[model samples]
Target: MTVAGEWIEKITGPFEDKKRYREYKARTKLLPESHRTAVEALDRYLMYFGSIGKSDVLLRMVDDLIDLFERAAADGTPVRDVVGEDPVEFAEEFLANYADGMWINKERDRLRRAVERAAGEESEKEGESPR
Candidate 1:
């Protein structure tokens, strides 16, 4: 999911739209207390990719998902704990839980598919070029 400001705006009605709410939350350093651990984990995970300061979308979505995971974890409802029926099911479940907002899942899936396609193409190219 893309975590559109619209959903946040709707979820937090009368406060402000999603954009304004993000600013408000950022200035106040306010996230559900439960999410502290997960959010911290997320921060560390993000560091591996580079500082969020370098990418606006990454900064926002990463921040938001961390907050969500933290909240869910605190509630004793961590997303990662959800069991899947099988490998494919588990992968889908994991991705869904990891993704935040509306188009986030779609984007993640697209990226995953692209990577897989690239790998397949590379194998085919190698196979055709070699004996």
Candidate 2:
């Protein structure tokens, strides 16, 4: 598999597994109130794609959406401010940018490298060989 394919598979594995999905759903209850809505949104979005088995593109989109929310939250930005009045429109605009050839390939490469680097760091921490 290509690096992007490997990264997507790794990230989406839990969402694809029934047992993991149940565990993830249960764990959401423990998140802070501020983060709960974002988690729920991600869950619903994942489910929408899961039902259709359209995971390849879904994984990329979900990854981007999660990063966007995480950065916004970490920066203490209100969801309303980040997404504006119509979140659907905001998301559509965000996705449209990726539909452009230049942005899509650049973003994909960046995500792939980030995932690979994170995996390597994790393996190093555990004293295991990197993949």
Candidate 3:
């Protein structure tokens, strides 16, 4: 017995189009071992923390990640130099640049709206400004 919400989600869930993700995985395979390992670590981090909501933006971010590793591999650049000592910081900084694609941005907007309503700064008016 499938729920209506489940059916609706099946038709409109995030990442329904996975072609770009497949391509990203293929590209990752071509990198040198060390670069590939660095990428895998960053990919794992991004999957858990990036929370990119838009498919196009996620694809772009992955493509860019591939591009950076590919260039570093070609140039014989060390993986440590590529990701730096604090990789979590590097991954987070990379994610910060793509703020528009992050799900947290939506939650932040919702939080702001709720806070405004509670504080009487916002009204129940249908045409009220988002800010």
* lDDT scores of the candidates, listed in order: 0.49, 0.59, 0.85
List model 3 lDDT by residue over 1-131, tens digit each.
25986887677654445767887899999888889889988999997898897877888889899999999999999999988999999999998888899999999999998888887677646566544
Q: What total of clashing residue pairs does each candidate reach?
A: 9, 0, 0
User: Which of the numbered candidates is closest to the native, going by highest lDDT?
Assistant: 3
- lDDT for position 116 in model 1: 59
TM-score ranking of the models: 3, 2, 1
lDDT of 2 by residue, 33-131 (tens): 666586576457534423324344445555555656666677877778867897666655665544533334666788987886777975766788887
Model 2 segments more than 4 A misplaced: 1-32, 42-53, 95-131
TM-score per model over all chains: 0.30, 0.41, 0.78
Residue ranges of candidate 1 with Cα displaced over 4 Å? 1-34, 50-54, 70-76, 79-131
- After the best TM-score superposition of candidate 1, give how far the Cα of residue 119 lies from its true spot, in angstroms: 18
Which clashing pairs does model 2 show?
Answer: none
Among these predictions, the greatest TM-score belongs to 3
lDDT of 2 at 4: 88
lDDT of 2 at 43: 50
The residue pairs found clashing in candidate 3 are: none
